[model samples]
Target: MSVETVGIIGIAALFALMAFRTPVAFAMLLVGFFGTWILGGFRSSGAVLITETYGAVSNYSLVVVPMFILLGNIASAAGFSRSLYDAAYAWVGGFRGGLASASVIGCAAFSAVSGSSVATAVTIGKVALPEMKRLGYSASLSTGSIAAGGTLGFLIPPSTGFALYAVLTEESIGRLFMAGILPGILMMGLFMAAISIVTWLDPKAGPHGDHVRFLQKLKLLGKAAPLLAVMVLSIGGIYVGAFTPVEASGIGAALVILIALAMRALTLSAFYEALLDTVKTTAMLFTIVIGANVLNPFLAMTHIPETLGTALTTLGLGPYGSLAVIILAYVALGMFLDGLSMLVVTIPIVFPIIKAAGFDPIWFGVVAVIVIEMGMITPPVGLNVFVVKGVAEDVPMSAIFRGVMPFLMAMIIGLLLIIAFPQIALLIPNSMFG
Candidate 1:
């Protein structure tokens, strides 16, 4: 059989494996391995799998993943995440739907360090949900805000989503990191706006939080300052070229550890748990990377990406029209696949089409991340929604999905604005690099 025909069959097998509930990593690895064996000799396929596994695990840039994950886990264990939320609440809690706004702001701040939506949602949801409930905030507004806001973890700097995107596309991680800043801020503001509208339409849905004195606010900010400082030192250092991503990540992790120990907030048991959690999360991410690497070569040999790119360019839809189709495809896939799996599996196919159509790759990275973020709140397979449900066990899952709808609308608006003005994603990166 021809190699291209084998590639087509491999693609079919991939979807079949996924449909049968095989883990995405193993599915990709299996398809890539056996397809290559079928096309080439057994020896070559074995060599590909072994070498790619080692290379993915040992990659220097990927060290940023674990360090950042460790930094976030330690902060959560140490109660810094609570401090961050408290600070936001102190300042914003008095406004209508203020606690929900604070939840979003809290998620964005935490995203600067954590970089995982599940972690962001869990940490903030654990702290925010009960308080919102006590303050009489509606379940939909309370849970929805955090579920949507947690998505900031994927769009903000030090994001695992962006890190994996960089690895897949060979884009500059630093540039992508910088690129995400304004868009992240934009999305956060939009989320807050959605909160305002929700409460404005139905005042009782989110009652005003207790008024915090200016002195108390100052004290809360003081408690939150250490995290802000660490974020500035690490993410800020990358922006100024004062450190590589690896250096920034290492420094961030070490700083968080020292701060936690110095503050006496982290017990040895908690620290041990943080380390173990980091290791498990890091291992899962690494496996996904390895699987993608294994699968990519088989796909390349089949020339599927090239063929898809050619087909896209010849469609005469024009660039923006074509982009709409790609975005739609992402939205559809988001309902079924988790964000990371969607990113790794699809970028190899969509990226070439994007490049051929003349969009800036870094800008597209921001666009792709934003669209995937929406999926975190999108129903049927809304990962963040499920994560939030774990924290608010009493809230019906349907209510959680209902709650995210406003924020989901907010995401669409934010995405449209970014598309209309690409500089929202590119401004910082261009200014810093140029």
Candidate 2:
């Protein structure tokens, strides 16, 4: 059979396996292994899978993933997220829909450390939902804000999304992290605006929270200062050339642990749990990486990426038009696939077309992540919405989905802004790394 035909069959088999609820990693591994064996020999496919697994696991740069994840897990166990919510609440909680806005800010602050959207939603939801409920906020608005804010975990600096994209595309982790900074802030602002509009349309949806004295606000801010400091040091250190992304992760992890210990919030048992969770999460990430690596070679043998890129170029669609199609595909796939799986599965095929079109990979990484974040809130398979629902059990799942709609629109607008002005993503990375 022709190589293209083999590639098409392989892709079909892949989707079929996924349809049956096969783990994405194992599905890719099985398809990639057998496909490579068919195109090459068993010997070459065996070598490829073994080598890819080893390479993915032993890569030095990847240490950043677990280290950053550990920092987030430790921070969560130690109550740092609550302090962040408190600080945001002290400042913004008194306005109409202020509690929900504070939840967005709090989510952003925690995401700066957590780097996982699900974790961000769950952590902030546990803290923010009750307060919003007490303040008479609507379930839709309250749950909606937390779910939407959680997406920041994937867009903000130290994002796992950026880190994994860097691994797949050979982009600089530091530059990708920098690229996300401005866009993350812009997204957060847009979410806040969504809350403002939601509350304005129905004041009953979000009532005023408690007013705090200036001294009280400062005190709450002081309580959360350690988290802010850790964020600045880890992410800022990269921009200023003080540390590599990996080093920054290590430092951030150590700093958060020490802060937790100093506050008497981290027990020996909690530390152990943090380590365990980090290992589990890290192992999951590595499995996906290795699967992608194995599958990438099989794909190369089939020449699918090259053929697809050539086909797209022949279509005479300009760069922006081509980009629109890709983004639309992601939105469709996101209805069923998790962000990480969607990313790993598609990058092998998509990255080549993007590069051929002369688009910047780093900027594309930011754009890709924002779209993935949108998927996390999109319905039928809205991962973040499900996560928030789990935490706010009293709030119906439908309400959470309804609440996330405005934020989803805001995300689309932010994405368009970034598309029209790539510099929003490129400015910091170009200035710092040049």
Candidate 3:
């Protein structure tokens, strides 16, 4: 049988595994190992597995994943996430839909540390949902805001999405992290604007929050300052070349733990739990990396990516047209696949087309991350939506999906603007790197 035909079957088997609720890492591993054996015999498959496993686990760059995740887990245990939400609420809660807006802002801040969309959604949703419910906010608006806002975790600096993308594409993680800053801020603004539009259309949806005295606002901001400062120094340090991504992650994790202890917000048991959670999360991500590495070699042997790229070029679509098709494909994939899975499965096939078309790789990274973030809220597999549902238990799942619709539109708009003027993503990375 032809190699390409075998590759197609492997792809189908991978999906079948996923449909059965198999973990993504194992699914990829199973498909790649058996498929490689089919094409190259047992010895080659064994070597691929052993070598890829060691490479993924021992890669020094992966250390950032554990450190950044620990930083976030510890921050949550320390109650710093609450301080961020309170500070945001103190400033914006008086406006219509202000509480919801604050939720988005708080998610962005926490995302700077956490870099995991589900974590951002859960942490902020737990804090903001109760307050919005108590204050008579509409369930759709309140729940939708947290769900949409959590997507920022995948876009902001220290993002595991970017980290994994960098590892797969061999692009600069620091550059990708830098590239995301402006777009992340822009997305947060768009989410807030969507809240304002919702509240304006139906004032009953979101009542104005109580006015806070300036002194009280200042007090809450002070309480949030420690984590806020950590975010700035870590990200800013990257921009100025003060440290490598790994260094920033390590330092940031250390700073957060120290600050949490200083505030007496973290008990020893909580600290231990954070460490355990970090280890588990890190192990899961590493397994995915190893699986991708194994599968990638099998894919190359089958010539699927080369064949697909050639077919795309044959379509007579200009670069922009080809890009639109790719973007649409990503949207379709996002509905089913998680961001990391999409990145790992598709980048080898797609990145070459994007590069051959003369598009900037770093800009494409931002665009890809944004599209994956969109998937986090899109239906069927809207991971963030389900997370928000877990927190706001009484709210129907349908309400949360309906609420995220406007923010999803905002994402489309933001994505178009970035595509039109690539500089929005490129400006910071260019200025800093050049």
- Taken over the whole model, the C-alpha lDDT of each candidate is 0.94, 0.93, 0.93
What's the TM-score of every candidate structure?
0.98, 0.99, 0.99
RMSD to true structure for each model, in Å: 1.0, 0.8, 0.9
1-434 per-residue lDDT for model 2 (tens digits): 99889999998998899999998898899989999999999999999999999988888888899999999999999999999999999999999999999999999999999999999999999999998898889999999999999999999988999888988988899999999999999999999999999999999999999999999999999999999999999999999999999999999999999999988999899899989999999989999999989899988889999998888778898888889889999999999999999999999999999998899999999999999999999978999999998998888888899999999999999999999999999999999989
Q: List runs of model 1 lying over 4 Å from the truth.
A: none
Model 3 per-residue lDDT tens digits across residues 65-86: 9999999999999999999999
Model 1 lDDT tens row, 1-434: 78879989998898888889998999999999998888877998999999999988888899999999999999999999999999999999999999999999999999999999999999999999999999989999999999998999999998999999999999889999999999999999999999999999999999999999999999999999999999999989999999999899999999999999999999999999999999999999999999999998899888888887777778888899889999999999999889999999899888988998999999999999999998888979999999999999999999999999999999999999999999999999899898
lDDT of 1 at 366: 95
**lDDT at 323, model 3:** 92
